[model samples]
Target chain A: MRLRLTPRDPSYFDLFAAQASYLVVGANLLAEILGADRATRKDINRRMAEAEHAADDATHTIMRRLNQTFVTPFDRDDIYNLASSLDDCMDFMDEAADLIVLYKVDELPARVSDQVQVLQRAAELTAEAMPRLRSMDSLQEYWVEVNRLENQADKTHRKLLAQMFDEITDPILLLKLKEIVEKLEDAADAFEKVANSIETIALKES
Target chain B: MRLRLTPRDPSYFDLFAAQASYLVVGANLLAEILGADRATRKDINRRMAEAEHAADDATHTIMRRLNQTFVTPFDRDDIYNLASSLDDCMDFMDEAADLIVLYKVDELPARVSDQVQVLQRAAELTAEAMPRLRSMDSLQEYWVEVNRLENQADKTHRKLLAQMFDEITDPILLLKLKEIVEKLEDAADAFEKVANSIETIALKES
Candidate 1:
């Protein structure tokens, strides 16, 4: 029996992972932005906005690769979906930060900060997992860890929301906190989607 | 150049569309379940719970088609992304309804109901647009209409959320309402994703 490998060139998956890594950096920046005091809202949100643009650029490169290339290091659909999934994660982060700026939130909620930390961790795990995708032997192990991180993030998201409802007395603050928590949850879900896509790639490879 | 006049089989797209239509029906059922009397919670939520199984079935069929078929009616990546987007919409709706059942909300907020209706309309447009993918020329108008409907749904979602924050008094109720509205907004976003995918297909044909 002969094993066939997908022909590779510019390494879309690698570029995609770099973008995912940038998203994590953006998440960290957002965390810092939220924690920072009395800074201009524009300055705080800039990192997140740039992250969104970077993700989009990666997605555009992915589309071009899919169109012009005959072979990929991964499945064509997987490449596109993974790019979009990472983009979705950044999109949520950017949206959450944008909301904070738009609403002129004075103080960052501790719960939101915790969820962002989890998201940063998850994004880092995702970036780590991407290179191993080229080799089928290690895909399962990375995906399991990714899935575990996502589950942990989900638990944090639920707990944060529950606490937000319990402790927050102001209606506007409650709404803002809930939005931030849910945005974090959505971003976590996006990460999970990438993990699931990786699972599919594993299935395809195996 | 001779146009490829061969009519590819519609069974795949047809089945896919039918399942999406069922999901919309399920969304309506959820709206009804959420709005039902407390006495009916057990029965209505149970039925809504069952929709997950049905959605899974639809998803399985779509995935199978994606795996086995090479020349899809549309771009393979678009088909895959659109399928997952539809599934996500159903999943979010199901998750929100499950939350309602678990939280034991006695009465439905009018805003949640309004958002659900918008989602239903968007889903209907999706089901309508699916068959047109088989013959892009025939569905050009529908594609445009679906995009317009998505725009309408987006406006409704934003306006509804604004009103939700403006009118709701209790912090707890405000949290629940925000979650429900956000879930519905996501459903609308999923529909818009599909609409955008179709427009991309239309562009290819034109």
Candidate 2:
């Protein structure tokens, strides 16, 4: 779809898209971290911290843009919510990675990797969807697709959580894994918040 | 401070204040549920559900207002965030109450009541703070006090959880009580979010 030629540039939305892309990159780093042993765990955490910093930087950039740009590609409030929600996704990913690294978890739980992969994909889709918001067209279609992807992530999360509950023996392990899974799942939920807000914006515009 | 006229009429903000007050009312009902004995549990649950229904009505009212209003008394995004956060508090309280009711907890746990009471008071403060947004001219000082109360609630929550962990015996009881305390504490956290947003709004206006 061709981008709508609004009176103002869509730089704020572009910054938001970049923020989400950075989160996807962070999720990939987490996936890579799952393979590292104890010795490399610290280094992996350091790398994850760097990714978090990048996400934070993206957040500040979006905020600054929001302050300066009178005419946003989307609703000003939607831009703020989307920006913060993307940052939250990164924050959760960094936290999960930090816990694994700090606790010296014996092994990377399969569900952790799976959830990160789900988040990575969701972040990608969110980034892709942002540009489309600039166009005064076909947004409802994109909204539906994002909603479907979000629902898929939710289902995958619940399935993985049930699996984790069935397989884990130690109570501490169970609790930690439950938290990680819930956090990742919640990140997807947060993404859905952004999508829902975008839908609101689109409907209002139309 | 005199009430400054808002960008929108009194009805919109009045609805928000009413919804916030409704949540506080739900918190009180939740506290009552925590005080009930096992035999009287059914009655407690019924009252709690009634409170929850009222809270849901408040949420719907706020959402309708948000959708219809253009120029708001405060930042439109902040207004939405405040309403959603307040509704989330109600949702959590209802969930905890429902769980206890379904499980037929033998008696009111001290930790459960402790957290609920703190949450109840915090919600009250939040309800009080909501209307102050209408009068940015007069209630700037009240915003600070509300934040301090929220901070106090957080410290209380942490101390309560620590005491709960240290004092509780019976593994199953410990688990159940822990979840209840966490949910109730989270309700307080939601109140804090509302308070913080109000503080921000106050700062912007002042």
Candidate 3:
């Protein structure tokens, strides 16, 4: 319902929504990889990598459009950051998947599944939030929840680290688990950053 | 001497230079920690923490000024990113030192020092480059050298990982060392980001 003298394209919202949708796919692929057998994990990881590449392509398209577009929905840097952080979510998830296979980790601790569940939940919330960017409606709730979830994820990460050091016998295995868990933690932080960027954009718009 | 209609503040350059100087101090502290005994490293770490807090205060100042000032010399987000990446360099170096003492590791790999050396050089180059932002001169060489150094650091990082995995028998020690090395790598990447940000700012100005 807003009228502007300059024409502002809205497809950027669609592109963001599309980009976020890949995160949902990537997070789900991560969940699937966590449960599958070794052979099955390799297969799932391949899918995750493909999803990551797709996200990468999506990010490239957004950046290219940003370069060509004159008037943007928000600040140009915010768009770049939003796209980069969204890509970060996929990249961290993909890296977690890749390391799981590369290290040949047989079975992860139960808490890791807890970590992935957080990613899945965050991804769903993020995917749901993107389209709403068009309206900038009900975004406060989305960011608040993501912030809460990120805090939960942080506590879980620290406890998981302590638990791993306490229980895991082999140092090499502990190292592998720690790195993967850290990647998941990194992904969670990335999601939190995405929400923060949205909050900034919405605030400026309002 | 180009004439401008609007007033623009240039102290952001000085603030940035001040921030990069802390990096130099912190990087040298890390090198000192590598050579000293546990007690001495603790003493040095105390200084590093102080330096980090100083850098954090500088960042806070930059952000505050950015919010209050109507017109910045360049884009606001680029200033934010530049300040942030500079802070990241200090942060990772601080974390690296903190881990060294926290893990109580007796000795580090020589390549670990190699990693620190790279940081030292980058910090020096970055501090030198901050003042040049006023005129945006010779920045291309700065960023080009930084990119080249980052590539060298990346190669060294992978080799360090393989060597650690191959040589270190104690898994816990390996875990500690790996985390520290990775932090150093993160700092290196952060410097590259700083350089890249400068390049972006310079290009836009040009």
**Candidate 1: where is the Cα deviation over 4 Å?**
A1-10, A27-77, A94-110, A200-206, B1-32, B35-50, B68-82, B85-89, B95-105, B109-206
- Per-residue error for A200 in candidate 3, Å, reads 7.6
Q: Please, what are the lDDT tens digits per residue for candidate 3 over residues A39-158?
A: 999899888877877787777678767655679989998999899999999999998998888777889999999999999999999999998998999999999999999999999999
- Chain A TM-score of candidate 3 vs. true chain A: 0.94
Candidate 2 lDDT over A91-176, as tens digits, reads 87788788787666777566566667767777777767767767746666656776777778766775675565456657677666
Q: Please give the lDDT score at residue B89 for candidate 3.
A: 92
The number of the candidate with the highest TM-score is 3
Q: Encode model 3's per-residue lDDT on B147-180: one tens digit a residue.
A: 8889889778867876887788887788889899
Candidate 2 residue runs with Cα over 4 Å from true position: A1-10, A28-57, A64-78, A107-114, A141-175, A200-204, B1-68, B71-78, B95-108, B117-159, B169-176, B189-206
Q: What fraction of correct interface contacts does each candidate retain?
A: 0.14, 0.00, 0.14
Docking class for model 1 is: incorrect
Model 3 per-residue lDDT at A1? 22
> What lDDT, from 0 to 1, does candidate 2 have?
0.69
Which digits, one per residue and each the tens of the lDDT, describe model 1 over residues A1-206?
21112224547756776667767776887777677655666776876676677667667778887899897777776777888888888888888888888777788667677788878888888777876766656777767877787878877776676666667678787777667667878888888888878777777666
Per-residue lDDT for B1-206 in model 1, tens only? 22121124436576567657756766787768766776686676667667666666667677766776667777777777777777777777777776675555667666667667777776676777776667664666665665676677678777777776788776578667666667777777777776676777678768
Per-prediction CA RMSD (Å): 9.2, 7.8, 8.0
Global CA lDDT computed for model 3:
0.87
